[model samples]
Target: MAELVLVTGGSGYVAGWCIAELLNRGYDVRTTVRGPGKEESLTQAVSTVADPAGRLTFAVADLLADDGWDAAVKGVDRVLHVASPLGITAGDPAAMIAAARDGTLRVLRAATAAGVKRVVMTSAANTASPSSYATEGTTDETLWTDPDDPTLIPYRRSKTLAERAAWDFMSGHEGPTELTTVLPGAVFGPILSTGTIGSVGIIGRMISGSMPGVPRIGLEIVDVRDIADIHLRAMTAPAAAGERFLATGEFTWMREMAHFLRDGLGPHGHKVSTRQIPDFAVRLTARFRDPSLREITPSLGRRNRHSTDKASRMLGWHPRPAKQTVLNCAQSLIAHGAV
Candidate 1:
């Protein structure tokens, strides 16, 4: 009999790929949805990459509530807790933090009680980064971002607090189940469907000419497919238990990303603006014109990057090049008519 793996947030971009990969690897997979309405779209999305073949199933659950979690973890061999609040752009910081932290705990408590072999959770690379991206140095999982730092954005703060809460919970845990976390950078790659693109919307904006100019910000771009691969590796690796692995890719600037799209997509890339937006202009726009740009002002001329040597050495993981990931993301957006 195949081991059954329960994946939370089956409708998510990363979670969808994780489901597809698990099914392809011959695992009997069960996933959670907030309601029945998402079941059809989630199945349709996962079907794009791998067939469920009667091995896939669904459970109704919500992170903010506890009614369905226990039943969701019944007889599960492993768990992948990949759902997090997507309030990175705008939301009440306190509300977002509460939801993310409490949601993680909800899943952990259920999985531990069920005696799942391992629970691999998805965290962000920024949770291990310096408060200021201008700090020049390569960081690893050993470093923990200070959640109280006022400079930290809601997304970073929420992720940091949530992961910290998970570790704190595990420290007191006495169970067979173990916890592992995969911290990915800016995740980008092919989309299974057009329903939810997540960060891949940045690529869509560039391809559709929505962005008039590029910022000086740089990102450690990792592919969505690679993100799913590392999750599976962490689920079964003995050394991965109770360890946090940084899964990041090459650091590339927005201007370079624009160039990659322009050069790689031919007619589709023609509208990509490679022009750099001045730091002052971006700051000014964030201050008055568009408040949504505020989240990016602090990232101008970012100098810090993360080291994935730990993931490579421990899990034998290697992410594809940033250029290829960028081009593939843009092409997918075009094909889906998302642009």
Candidate 2:
């Protein structure tokens, strides 16, 4: 009998790829959806890459609430908790923190009780980063972002808190089930469906000409496929338990990202902006024109980078090149008519 792995959030961008990779590798898979209607679409998305052939199943589970989790983890051998709070730019910080932190505990409590072999949760690379990106150096899993920093944004703070809470929970846990965490930076790459694009929205906006200029910020772009691969590696690897792996890919400035898109996608990338937006202009816009731009003002001229040495040395994981990942993401958005 094949090992059965439970991937939470079937409809998510990363989770969808996880499901496809799991099925491709001959693992009987089950994924969680918040409600009933998403199952059909989720199956359709995963089917584009690999045939489920009745090896895939679905369970209704929401992280914010406690219902449906116990039944969801039943009979599961391993779990990939890939779900996270979304659209966090303009919401109540308290609610987002609660959803992320409490929701993770909810999954952990249920998975521990069910005696699942291992639970690999998806966290962000930002969780292990310095509060200010002004420092120049490469950081790794040893560093921990301060969740209570007053300057931290809701999204960063939420991810850090959630990961911290999970570690804290496992410390007191005296059970057979183990825990591992994979922290990915700026997930990009091919999309299974356009329903949830996540960070790929910036590429969509750029390709659509909605964004007139690029910011000075840099991103450690990791392919979604590579993210899925690392998650699977972390799930079953004996050495991965109680460890955090940074899956941050090659670092590319936003200006360089624009050029990559423009050069790679000739006709399709015509609208992509190659001009860089000045820091003062971005700050001005954030202050008076659009408050949403405030979040990015801090990242202007970001100097910090994350090292993936831990993941490479431990799990033998390597991510695709930044240019390849960027081009693939842009082309996929164009193909899906998302631009």
Candidate 3:
């Protein structure tokens, strides 16, 4: 086999795509799972999108523990740190932040200790989004999310803090290591396997009619395949060192998304609702009718736009537009009989 690459959380929806890209590119993969027994799932996920002859190995590693990560990194040319504690609503912000910040630092420390030359971390647009406050002006990579803002989502806060922790660790590390961060906006696209893609549940719920109206949020989406490609590019592309690449394209709001999906299915897609719910109506109705709407009410009427200018210039990355992302997602759900 050629040089090996270590992928953390290979069984995860996002990481699974990363591993698939690595395997398709003919990299020997040593993936770390929270349990060694989940090797079947990892192998299956990789196999779903990879060639039949791809090579995959697995180890047990927990982000909270220091047990197997060092060994998992041995002889690997690059590390893809995609593991982080992800949750929507949590009882404790400190616990969530620790899992994100400390968990990332732990892996980086292990990578340094194991002499890995390059690391491509899975970051998110949430790290840089200004959704907590009114985004008056155009925002891009230059902006940082206001984590202390009371309106920030717990998951967004976790991602922002974790990415910040990673940058700090990289700055202080004396090792001959390079770190590249791939920050994708709210990701949506087809699943490589029968299993679910984690971040797409909200979209899926909307498609399945479980969500009557979409979140007030807008998504700057790119294909999962495109996001995975940038991770690989970030690993070896010399210019990508110490860079944060935004793997995204144009933005799509709730009504735009519904239209995109509805257009795709022709007859079937017509079932989608394109009515834009007024922010006040949804908010007021939530108190008397539905709590689920209340859960997503905080993000109502927010505009989210991310600039991928740096990505195109530095990594030579080009992402599929958000419209295609929504269309493909709807098509995939229909093909899989989920819609």
Worst 10 residues of 2 by lDDT: 84-93
Who is ahead in lDDT, 1 or 3? 1
Q: After aligning candidate 1 to the native by TM-score, how far in Å is the CA of 103 from where it should be?
A: 0.3
Query: Which lDDT value does model 3 have at 198?
Result: 71
Model 2, range 97-123, lDDT digits (tens) per residue? 988999899999999999999999999
Clashing residue pairs for model 1: none
Enumerate residue pairs that collide in model 3. Answer: none
List residue ranges in candidate 1 displaced over 4 A.
87-90
Model 1 residue 308 lDDT score: 95
Q: What TM-score would candidate 2 get against the native?
A: 0.98
Question: What is the lDDT for 172 in model 1?
Answer: 93
**TM-scores for every predicted model:** 0.98, 0.98, 0.92
RMSD of 3: 2.3
Scored by lDDT, the top model is 1
- Each model's lDDT comes to 0.92, 0.91, 0.78
lDDT string for model 3 (1-339, tens) is: 587998888777788888888877878888888875887765765676686354788878887777887888888888999886764225676788778888888889989887888999998877877755455445667777777877776777888888888899999988888899988877778876556567776566666666566546666777877888888988989988888887876777777888777676677665567677778888888888976566577767667577888888888889887887777776776676665
RMSD of 2: 1.1
RMSD of each: 1.2, 1.1, 2.3
